[model samples]
Target: MPEIAPLLGETLTSPTAFHAPLHAPHEEDQWWRSSVIYQVYPRSFRDSNGDGTGDLPGITGELARLAELSIDAVWLSPFYTSPQRDGGYDVADYCDVDPRFGTLDDFDALVGRADELGIRVIVDLVPNHCSSDHALFQSALAAPAGSPERAMFIFRDGRGEDGSIPPNNWQSHFGGPAWTRTAAADGAPGQWYLHLFDSSQPDFDWDNPAVRAEFERVLRFWLDRGVGGFRVDVAHALIKAEGLPDWGGRADGGSTEGFPGWEAPMFGQDEVHAIYRRWRAILAEYDGERILCAEASIDPLPRLTDWVRADEMHQAFNFAYLHHPWNAHALRDVISSSLTAFDAVAAPTTWVLSNHDVVRHTSRFGLTDGTPRGGDGIGHGDPQPDLHTGLARARAASLAMFALPGGIYLYQGEELGLPDHTSMPDDARQDPTFARTGGERIGRDGCRVPLPWRADQPSSGFGGADSTAAPWLPQPEGWAGFARDVQAADPDSTLSLYRTALQLRRDLRLGAGSLSWSRPFEQSDVVAFLNGEVLVVLNMGEFAAPLPPGTVIAASTPGAVEDGLLVPDACVWILSTAG
Candidate 1:
């Protein structure tokens, strides 16, 4: 294989511009309203240096791949300088890149390459917490209780006589107590600091003016470097309620019938909106309609819309749609609710299925129950999913999702029909959730396996043929069959389906169109919707359904329409022939 040439100092141009021609001149600034953003987990996307981990240079090399899929932008997960305690979410420095992923120069090259391909770049911003090794945190550790450094974080005295007990009963999202007692100058247990996640990641004290001002600087630092925007990680959890009161709610936001909703002390505080309003103002100062997207997991679906108010964030993840079961009625309800809620706020709904944080939808849809597994990821001892069934459902789901009126997010490698490494050995797992839970709850490592680009290459071509180390997470042997090269050659493969769907989506202006349930199948297992002249039909029943009245333009399964009947677990896009 050949090395990817350095994009620096090169004359960048879009020779194969796929999306620019499709967008109307008046719609240039509003591209994100109906765009397709590809989420690239930097560690698993591609490795250019033959190192086990993927780097910015590798992502710069793959800009063409995203352009080929008609993607509007690439949303990169955290590649910030970190201790790697929580997959790089534990940020030690907000302004620079980690050595493992490359330097600030490599990041600039990636932004340039993406610009040349007519695609925007959205980098992850983690403001909720910082790595324990961060200079501020380090200074806090060494400073006295009333020092300025300690004021930058949430530090409080322990409750008990010996100060051994935690200040509160709050729990960590990973597991156990959310507070960790730190040693004083004399080396005895002292002030306890709050951490919503692992101990290595301490939650920031948003109440502090310095913390807010620091994040403002960080935001401008990236925006000035030509990044189009940011995907604010844990967007809603940045500000906690006053006094850090203890409550009966689950720390992870899982349902407890008696717990509070939007007013929860730990998350979804009303004060967080002010932070975003300030960030939005900073974004407005820049050109090219820069954006801010929230990764908030607020409940009731409607509450999540608050983050995307007119002057705040431009988009918020539709997690309700992602977690809904595969049932037609349930899916319809989620779509309806999401559209209604987002429309009220005049914001475009951002649709997504699989991301880096959860189990892949392929495996989730394959389960016998046909519902999300929640946090209990599949392990070797767990019941295996039916891959065939899952892939079919996933393909069908993609067609339906593309035809919806909103922005969409595609997780890397889902286009290749990859499933989770459900049988990965326990000893190889690296996710902090797995270790914090003592292996009782399998972590997201299965879905974060490095992508395979070639069938016959080492590590399936993730680190290239000359790679000196194995991938950070082991790739399953069967993954060779799902390599991009293998699927790109098969017209009926999922990769091909995604390409076709994206092309049609662009040509027909489906993302900007309206969606209305095909009246005939509104109450049935067949989900049929009309997007302008296009009619998308998804058959989720056990038997074939009569094909809707239109000419079939594309289908998830080849020959999906047989004898004028649509097969079960299949989806089709139809061109309406009626006047």
Candidate 2:
């Protein structure tokens, strides 16, 4: 057993400093070194087919936008076969595309097109579980005792009454029990199979060799299709609590939080990096210059370096920002901790503000809904207005995300400053969880709503022929106000800001983890940062902070840090000098 060190001084004590590495850090291929990865939720991107569902062809057509912006890569959500249980997150088959998304050929075409545009293509890989409709589950249901398929799914020995119940105490992410009896046994009668998410998405048993082999095959399938790399979904969740114990927590404990009697590993587990290393080996087979930005949260930096060896997942998402308070101290502490981990792990990092899963950034900084009253634990709160206040915070966040070290992932609509539209009628809920779980889960439908491609066009220029005529979700009121068309023309628009930041990242080695965050002084309202030599200030309050003496590099809102008393809820800037 490794000796635990009592971390003292500037760093926290830890059992072991993260040093895992699946692949060596690429100093030369800086394309993704500190690249800002912008995620595109296909359904919300342009709808090319007019089927009301975003497809591969549409992504291919829009590849130029990312290339022109010099975004290192585009992380597309699962276009694979699925029951759409969790917004195309549940995979029905690893090798095929769901018809609703288009054909495998279409995927190939999109990949080819993205490559042509110099934009790398990274598909989301959901390996933790598969759609209940997946053939492997069905085949396993038919397998006799000791059959390989039987070992694929977590089918455990049931105790007591109706064998339909599982052997552990875990809750499904969607709701209800985690285990359900498989009645369609080809050889065996009703037995139990565990599902951490929805009944339709059953967890895969990584303890089994066959299961591992099958997953390898699935990964190779995409690599063979000329994919740059993969965005591992719930990467650490690949391994479950070996001892199925009841985890105490009303909030979906069984899924990962519900470990009864044990260490109950959740997001990132120690044994999981080995699996990532295997992926590294596979990608190397094709000489692919790609990365595996793990969708890991909790135990991320514990073994950060280990995950991105010359071989494992290249980067893991630093969610410190997601979990931190909306204050300079909180942000500073999170970044400081992150830097320590990055230094310890020797592995690079992936940073994110908003993704398909979380609430939009505009809402997080008291911009949108202003603030959620109490932890009602309901939806991510109503539409966050005060755009005046929110927009400033957003600009600060953008500068911070871009200036910080590692790969930064921008949500699809973030570039345009789209806020979640909470004004939708109650009956219009599009998320299955909201419809099934009463909206507390805050399903991602609002952010996943269709993209507004055209400003003048009602369909946001996505489609006018059916799909464009009627989007999957209603557009936010402030959307057309910042549409791409309008922003494309306005040099000061958010889109312009996004492009400028990305360009600076590429041209200047700012993507490299060379950021030295200046100590954030307790000011009136704005938070500031010294990016290299330039001080980036963000205004969070309604009023502007006085402009501090120095040349201003950029300002999110009309605010400045004068004499140290910064403005309210806005970003401020000052250039750095060798002196």
Leading candidate by TM-score:
1
Sequence-dependent TM-score of model 1: 0.94
RMSD per candidate (Å) reads 9.1, 7.7
Candidate 2 Cα errors over 4 Å, as ranges:
1-29, 161-165, 184-189, 249-262, 265-267, 300-306, 367-385, 464-469, 519-526, 539-548, 558-566
User: On a 0 to 100 scale, what is the lDDT of residue 288 in model 2?
Assistant: 52
Per-residue lDDT of model 2, residues 268-290, tens digit only? 45678788888888887786576
lDDT tens digits by residue: candidate 1, 1-579: 222112221111112211122111123338889989999999999999988999999999988977989999999999999989889999999999999999999999999989889999999999999999999999999889988899999999988788888988999989889999998667788899999999999999999999999999999999999999999999989888898888688887645688856657889999999999999999999999899999988898889999999999999999999897888899888888888888887788999999999888889999976445865689998888999999999999988999998899999999998999999999999888899999988988999999999888899989988887999999987998999989989999999999999999998888887776655566778787667667778888877777645578889989688766788889998876421
Positional deviation of 198 in candidate 1, in angstroms? 0.4
Q: Which segments of candidate 1 are over 4 A away from where they belong? A: 1-29, 577-579
Q: After TM-score superposition, what is the CA distance of residue 148 in candidate 2 from its true location, in Å?
A: 2.2
